[model samples]
Target: MIPVVPLDRSREAALRALVDGKAKPLGALGRIEDLAVRLALISGREDPSFDKALLLVFAGDHGLNQAGVSAYPSAVTTAMVATLLAGRASANAFARVVGAEVRVVDAGVAADLAPHPALVDAKVRRGTRNAASQPALTPDEVQSALARGAAVARRAVEAEGFDILAVGEMGIGNSASAALILHRLAPAPLADCIGLGAGHDAEGLARKHAVLAQAAARSDASDPPGVLAEFGGLEIIAMAGAILGAAAARTPVLVDGFIASTAALAAIRLEPAAADYCIFAHRSAEKGHALVLEAAGAEPLVDLSMRLGEGTGALLALPMVRAAAALLSEVASLDDVLAGRL
Candidate 1:
């Protein structure tokens, strides 16, 4: 893993002063003011540019679905990838509204998909092994997924000139995998992390709980990479890589929903510095997401009772990100305002 340097705080005091001097009541912008400070810290500029944004939606399949963990079949993973590539998915719709370019990555879908220009072919395997009885990914596959995800992110920032990055995922049964990850990584109780992922009923939720217990019992690995290999979906691991990549590039990463936050947890655990670059997008309706966010000490930007896990929540927050940057760059200082410089 590439080491990420923590944001330099040499200018933090100065940035805060600048934000405070803006033509408005002190802290009138609420969290938006805090956001501007972070943006400045990331860009090394008092007036950071957040004009260009990219959304990476990683699609994969989880073999754990075979254990009746999800309400939907694993086949839905492939179908949703097609839906995203066709520009008809909720993520695509949200991206259009926010003016962020969307790219779908074939991280580890179970089936081969037809080639599409917008799709990134970074599949590490057909699908993860059922973690209920075995490790989901091999050690080598875990490294490959991380490297591929980093490559995708580096390309977006270095080649495509994207100013910010948001990561989302599509993997049937991934919520179960994410729950397992949060349970182990967050060190939260397994029952606390388990939730009605993809709308499971009472009986289905009970079954999910039992299967996840089996998975948890199968491994005692506590480190990030080991835990990821034990239970992470390909998309989840890839999203972790993307977060690391974005942080290494000194770009802000908008982590979306529960599965995405679980990935962020892995990245931050791997490199603690990566946590400084992440903006938790929203509080997902998924019950366990609150626990994951709490463990990370993250205050999400909004709560819309959404669990749609397609980067939609992140995209919806893009406007606020833009507003944060705008406040720093466009607003006048109190000194200038009093001088009638306008």
Candidate 2:
């Protein structure tokens, strides 16, 4: 079990006082104040620093694509991974604007990826088995993926000195996998969890719905690990592991939309304390995202109609996180302002 320590709330009152003491009226900063408090609480510091942020985008293929769940082919997953590595994808552009570094993890991409410094080759296998036909991952593969994900996050903090972590994913037909995981674990109905992942048409959506129904029927597992192993894409499970790992290290993780939120749900379900360290980035245009966010009890920072995953939402939200930290560290207290101690 990952030893995810519960966030300490002992500093709440003091943190609130600090925020209220800022050279502004009470609640003037709005949700930023809440965000600052959360950052402080996560770091256990009155002046938390989010100067260095890392976005880990775990990429993989899903065997369930064979079942016609996605509008795109499995090959798109590889092409997207290449695009990300070439610094040409939407995620890379957003990351450049946000000043957060992006690293792609080969959790289980179907094709062999040439080594890139920014790519962490943690492939457990060449993708997972089709959940509609069999369990997506074996118990052992699940554990390994979880471990590698945790290690990646831990190293980011302990070795690379990043102050914050975020997670995204790339996998074709993985939305079907995420929906299945969310349906079983969120205990939401299967219908509620299904969405127009990667822009499915009416017929495509119907096919995805039917395929997910078949996968859901094949597994009755309600527990976190069991549910993940049964329906998770390898990248999805690795993203959960990254969440757990970040929480274990006591670093806040900015969770990206629908797919990443599903991973966060699995992580929190596996280790309840992990929820405290997650910052749900944004709601997406994806239909099922709202339900997943609701199930996770998360109020995201923005809703830009964004559904282009690969950490784009989280990267866009990074400035707000940086601003929150600045409010705590740079803003002066009202008392000092009044005393002309600026």
Candidate 3:
């Protein structure tokens, strides 16, 4: 695991004091106050600005889809990537409202996506092998995927001047893989981590149990990277690395629900320092999400029963994040009131 450059704590006490100095009564903003503090710490400044935002939808395929784990077909991943590229997905709608740029990544789609300006071709492979009986990706492929993921964030933040990043995935059946990954990383029981991913029915859930049970038994991922390489979808690995990259750049990273949280957990497991950069965007309708959120100690910014996995939750939360940053950077301080400033 690469060592993460830790968030600077020079302004830790001053930052909180400054947040309290806002014109409102202390703690009046609730979680919005927490969001402001977090954004401040990530940027390591008393004032943090988030006028630039990005939504990266990492698309991949899950070999678990070969089994009946999800209601949607595996082909839906590619089609949805196309939908995202066309700016017709739910995430795009939210991005439009929030004024965030949306970029689709071919992290590991089984099919070659047609060339599009909005798509960043960072595919590590066609898809991962079914973890039920085999490792998802070879160690080399996993390393490559992780590197690619980190590169995307680094490029955006360093070269393109991206301020905040929200990571989402478009892998059909990835929730099962996320469950498996969470089961290995967190102390929760395997059954506690399993959920009805992408609208599974009774038979589909039964199949999920049978196959994921086999995956748990077959996977021996003792460490964070091992867990990711052995059981994670390519996009999941990439998202984890992206979180790491954001932390390295000292930029806030919005973690979406369920599968995205699974990646956040992986990133934190890899380097605990990354947690400071993460702002969980929402809670998902999928079962076991609360448990994962608890394990990560994340209080989501919102909960809309949203289970759509395309950075939609993060997009919906973007405006709120921007507002928090705006308050930190532009809002009046108690000093202004003392000076009789309007």
Candidate 4:
């Protein structure tokens, strides 16, 4: 088990110096400045470099399909997973632009996918049990999903030599699951955080809310693990574990949209120290996403009304993070340029 560490004063000092550098005014870069500083502190490097980027896309299926919450069928998860492996998905295009490596993990798709070179094949189950009717996953399944996610992160940090981890998910009706998780974890109402996932109509939205409310009633928010086991999707559970594992390994994490943000919240709930290593990539347009970000105390870097959950937003924010790091490491201090004390 990797040991998770708290942010120390040394790391904090490094961030302050980097942010207070000469070329740019203090806090001028806004959240991007804070993001680079946080990344530097987490990696324990004054001149932090993000040359290697690892994106782990967790694919799963939700049992809530029976509730008519999603316009697409559960099989879409498997199809999209395959698409991702083929490097044809939108995430692929974005990742290609950033020169990042993408890996798809079948956390628990409903379909049976044969062995593929591009897919990790870490399926935990066929699909989660319908949360509207019963618990989403058994305790064993939840544990397995988390273990797989942690192992993925460990591999990226240790074996693959990646410095940063970005999380993404592909699961039908996952937006409903994310909203439910956020509602349970936060002291907020379901209506506040729920959104029109995948462009659902009024009837679909109502059904989604009803199913989520039922699941929430059966959940125990005081017990986060139990809540996750009962109502969280396989992708969400895996993401939570990945976040925790990355923090334990001192790898900076760029948290994506709504689903990813909810997963980060779950991980932080399990271990508060995990938040120290995370950078909120963007403010998702999903109704509940902003509330989740607020609950996490995270100010995201971008807010372009993005509803995509495939780490696309995080990929967009990467250049800003790199620029901040470069400024801290390469830009000369004002005193050095002026050749005198200010």
Candidate 5:
């Protein structure tokens, strides 16, 4: 069965009526009003809760990182995952601010991460091979990564009962991979998909563009899996699977920045119905992210010039998701308003 069920539009009127009947005037809750209706429709429950949310950071290295496209070294991917595990990373700080537990998955980091409570050791391989010169992974390897990602989402929802999810990626050159995916899936121009990731210089940006164009020209993804295996990092693949898994369980998801949005695109490509389960958290300062967000049919909650991954963007938006639910359940109805029960 497809993971995401088609949203039941039959109930739209009743749901919106409920939102409109809230104590405040119509649209007073603004986007949260829309958020409330959408969540109710997606979950098939008028009074759903955003009480629990899970954050997944899928970390990996990219062969394309060796091509000098990113300003950060590939080693930063593994190092940052270490910081995530230590709970001292920026993601953790925001996670605390937003109320969530963090889980780091070693999707395919080049370095070996020691066992940690917060880490899911689901490494597909050391890292992806250089896509500029070769295929990123075997088709079989791609499926493995996808399954690992889906399994994590399942555990979060089924075992832990998380009602919402956020998927993020950590990979140095994955931005190039994301661009390639958006170029293929979004079918945007190579230039439109290209961006100055991690602040590349003029020469670096030019070289980055040249390499991504070459990679795009050389590779073609025939299907969702093909698109992912051809250009996506392990972390990206896992994130896509997590999205699909969450959608399958009727759990809402907050998509993070460029790479995470690309993963969400892949998930939707695999199953278009998954889009109903996603909420874009924020726009990234990184280039090409807007195009990807457009392709995903998402309007982010904020634009804070945030480009850091590790699920921070979505975590920052967690309150909005929760607030929508809170308002829906806590506020008095218009009937109560008319009855002078406020």
Candidate 6:
């Protein structure tokens, strides 16, 4: 097990000095400056750089889709996973543009995909059981999913030597599951966070809300592990573990869309220090996402009205992170300026 690192005062002081030296008035960059400082602290480097980036897309299926929560069929999860591995998914295109390696992990898709060289067969199960009808996953399944996610993070950090990790998910009806988890974990109402997931109409949205409400009522928020066991999808639980593992490894984690944010929330609850390593990649257009971000006090890097959950938003924001790092590492300091340095 990778040990978690607590944020140290020395690291914080170095971050402050670096940010204050940026080519702007102190604190003028606002949250962007804060973001750079946070990245520095998490990586334990006075100057942080995401020269090598890895985006892990964990695919699964939510049994809750049987309740009409999503317009797309559950098979779409497997299909998208295949598409991603084929380098044809939107996430692949975005990652290509940003020069980041994308890896697709089969967390728990319902479909039986034959051995494909492109796919990382980290299957925890065929898929989660219906949460609206029963528990989404068994305790063993949840534990296995988390362990798989952590293993993936370990490989990314130890083998690939990635400086930044982005989290993404593909699961039908997962938005509903995330909403339920958010409702239970956050001090927010279910209705406020529920949204028209995957282009659901009024009736579909109504049904999604109802299913989440039922799951929320039955959940025991006091026991987060139990809540996750009872209502969380494999992808969400896996993501929670990834966040914790990434933090333990002291790598900067870029949280993707709504589902990814909810997973981060779960990991944050488990270890509050984990938040120090997380970067809210974007403010998802999903109705519940904004509330989740607010509840966690996360200021996202982008607000392009993105609803995509395949780490596309996180990839889009990577350039900004790279730029921040470059400024810190390459830009001249105030001492250089005062000494008439060229």
What is the lDDT, from 0 to 100, of the residue 126 in candidate 1?
Answer: 93
Candidate that beats the other on lDDT, 1 or 4, i.e. the better one: 1
Q: What would the per-residue lDDT of candidate 2 be over residues 1-342, giving only the tens digit for each residue?
A: 788999889888999999999999999989999999999999988788888999999999998999999999999999999999999998899888888898999999999999998999899999888889999899999999999999999999989999999899999888899989888888889998898888888999999989889988887999988998898688998999999999999999999999999999999889999999999999989878988888888999998999988999999889999999999999999999999999
TM-score of each: 0.99, 0.99, 0.97, 0.95, 0.97, 0.95
lDDT of each: 0.92, 0.91, 0.87, 0.83, 0.87, 0.83
Best by lDDT: 1
lDDT of 3: 0.87
Error of 2 at 291 (Å): 1.5
Q: Write the per-residue lDDT of candidate 1 for residues 1-342, one digit (tens) a residue.
A: 868999999888999999999999998989999999999999888778887999999989998999999999999988899899999999999999889999998899999899898899999999999999999999999999999998899889999899999999999999999999999899899999988988888999999999999999999988889999999699999999999999999999999999999999999999899999999999999979999898888999999999999899999989998999999999999999999997
Q: Which residue pairs in candidate 4 have backbone atoms (N, alpha carbon, C) closer than 3 angstroms, thus clashing?
A: none
Q: Which regions of candidate 4 fall more than 4 Å away from where they truly are?
A: 1-3, 340-342
Worst 10 residues of 4 by lDDT: 1-10
Candidate 2 — worst ten consecutive residues by lDDT sum?
Answer: 287-296
Give the range of the ten consecutive residues with the poorest summed lDDT in model 3. 1-10
The digit string of per-residue lDDT tens for model 5 on 241-286 reads 8998888888899999998999998888888999998899999998
Query: How many pairs of residues collide in each model?
Result: 0, 0, 0, 0, 1, 0
Question: What TM-score does structure 6 among the candidates reach?
Answer: 0.95
Q: Model 3, which residues run further than 4 Å from truth?
A: none
For model 3, what is the error of residue 32's alpha carbon versus the real structure, in angstroms, after optimal superposition?
A: 1.8
